[model samples]
Target: MNDNLYEIFHNVYEYKDKDTNNHFLLTENLAPGNKVYDEKLIRIQNREFRTWNPFKSKLAAAIKCNLKHFAFCENSIVLYLGAATGTTASHISDICRRGMVYCVEFSSYAMQSLVSVCEKRTNMIPILADARKVEEYLAIGKVDIIYQDVAQPDQIRILKINSQAFLKSGGIAYLCLKARSVDVRKSNSRIFKEATQELEKDFEILEKIDISRYEKDHMFYVLRYG
Candidate 1:
């Protein structure tokens, strides 16, 4: 409700500091006083908002880079792959307060931190499993959106497999492709092109964003599962 605070997307907001002229992307804090990854919290009109750091999250970076499609809603179920420490997932949790975010992570070390964050944010569910193994977490059922940030040679294949298993028809998917993970020798453009081509086989590319300013050699793809 602050005059400086503007809602950009559903539950997402932008706050501008008058004196400093610094703009920050924020989400209404779902856990009120809880802080995830030490992000700054602000209070406006009796509502708490958590600053979403674009430097720390590819999804936030994509939003900064003018990402057009935001399919996430207050009750949209999300399957978040490679949810390390639940930074972005927590923000998504704030957006989808009534829905669920199945946080799938491979590293046990990361899962420990993710679990702690999930505990504070009731909407986020921590799943300790590799993203490549979709069957391991099939009980999550169909989701409205799939957000993949896995770094692997088979990232495209992993997204396709998971989309087939969990994403409902016409559901949205956000793929954060790391070019170097696919092949160190290949150019970033080549890697992104190949990944896009593979994804086009089963999904429609809605938007392609270059998040290299925050994440080098990364191309963020917004796709709709067919």
Candidate 2:
């Protein structure tokens, strides 16, 4: 892994390691090869980099499952909802090196940690506000992407509201659907069906990937706003 052998896979660099079949995100290693929220770093090309653990991030899990779309890119403006402590948000920031990540989190306690992560990356912004209230961040204007990982029953509704306010037309969105959060008793497939039905009204469902291996009872949705 230290040979610096790297390949770009949908805006993320993958390490050529014959030891394991796991996929990883190539980060600039903002921190030393230490654990940031339980994520590890691997050195490649003589550059210290962090390994994007799939179990810790749905976006990483989707890539592990062969997701085709590369939604985020350099200089891409992104609106991230439910950015708890900036775990996945950090990886996104790594991919969008020249871009900005507007992280919206309601918990003040979590925002504190997120701010620490932002200090290391100039492009990352930490906002303490509820995702349901889009007006709070209306000044951010339109963004290229909207990523929502909120664990609420009305996650789809919340995403729709934020997309309408901040996301530009033709923008991409990655939503982590936690079936258990929506309904504890309903079948996972049935919950997904119901959510898709609601989301189809505003955005086109690009791809629905099962990420249960990393996050139990979860599905990752790739959407394109019309």
Q: lDDT per prediction?
A: 0.93, 0.85
CA deviation > 4 Å runs, candidate 2? 1-4, 18-23, 30-35
Q: What lDDT is reached at residue 153 by model 1?
A: 92
| Candidate 1 clash pair list | none
TM-score of each: 0.98, 0.91
Candidate 2: residue 16 lDDT (0-100): 62
Total clashing residue pairs per candidate?
A: 0, 1
> Model 2, 83-180: lDDT tens per residue?
99999998888778888999999999998999889888878899999999998889888999999999999899999999889888999999999999
Q: Which stretches of candidate 1 lie over 4 Å from their true place?
A: none
> 122-217 in candidate 1: lDDT tens per residue?
799999999888889999999999999988999999999999999999999999999999999999988888888888899999999999999998
